[model samples]
Target: MVTILFFGQLKERLDTSRLPLELVDGSKCLDSVAELRIFLQTKGDVWKENLAYGSALVAVNQQMATEDTPIKDSDEIAFFPPVTGG
Candidate 1:
């Protein structure tokens, strides 16, 4: 299982902070962070909206990550809306 945390507006929209994602059989993980987003979108309309919107920021292990960043076991993935404070 992989740990996924939601932050900022994402957390509020999702109405939860964290989730555990169980990889499907035959594979221990997904290909990359973007792929994970696609997978999460399958959950429901809320997930599809928040995760598939193509504008959220992603971090892996606290480091900013691109869509193609590789994902493996025990990784901590986080998603947050684009920062806009000024």
Candidate 2:
């Protein structure tokens, strides 16, 4: 299973702060960050735009990671809007 955490607008949009997903063959994994973006796109147009434009940031196991970051079972993934609190 993969633990997905949502923050800020993403959390409000998904109506939840966290979700646990079963890792299936085609499911989002460490090496498939793009796939995860696609999955989020399916949630709505806002997600599609945000993911496509890189408006959000993704983290794996508390470290920032690119879309190509490899994922594994029991991994923890978090998503948050681009930081603007400077």
Candidate 3:
């Protein structure tokens, strides 16, 4: 199982803060962040827009990750809008 954390507008759009996904054997190797976006899109348009947009950021195991990062079972992935703070 993979734990996906949603934040900010993403959470609001998805209507949930967290999502748990079960991965089959072939699904374990996620090569790009774009793939994750597509997976979330399966839920509906709201998830697709919020996550697939250019404004959102991705993290793996609490550290920022790019699309090429590999994903494994039990990995913690987080998605959120870009942060702006003074």
Candidate 4:
């Protein structure tokens, strides 16, 4: 099972705080963050825009992660917007 967490503006935009996916032999089971983004797109325009590549921050198990970062069944993944400071 994979635990997906959304934060900040991302949560508001997607109207979701958390999502859990059970890994199995199907499309829902993703290998990497890139694949996850593509999968999320299937949800519609809201997912596609919020999860766009190079647009959001990703973390795997509390550590920074990239688009190609591989995920495991028990991994805890989080996504959030890039921080901006004035």
Report every candidate's CA lDDT. 0.85, 0.78, 0.80, 0.88
Cα shift from native, residue 20, model 4 (Å): 0.3
Off by over 4 Å in 4: 25-28
Better of 1 and 4 by TM-score: 4
The candidate with the higher TM-score, 2 or 3, is: 3
In candidate 3, stretches whose alpha carbon ends up further than 4 angstroms from where it belongs are 25-32
lDDT of 1: 0.85
List clashing residue pairs in candidate 3. Answer: 33-67
- For model 4, state the Cα shift of residue 27 in Å: 6.6
Predicted structure with the largest TM-score when compared to the true one: 4
What's every prediction's RMSD, in angstroms? 1.8, 2.6, 2.3, 1.5
For each candidate, give its TM-score against the true structure. Answer: 0.86, 0.79, 0.83, 0.91
The C-alpha stretches of model 1 lying farther than 4 A from their native spots are 26-29
Per-residue lDDT of model 2, residues 1-86, tens digit only: 88989899988876788988766756434346667767767778866775564778999899998988877788899988988875
Tens-digit lDDT track of model 4 for 30-69: 8898887788778999899888887789999999998899
Cα lDDT, model 1, residue 50: 86
TM-score for model 1? Answer: 0.86
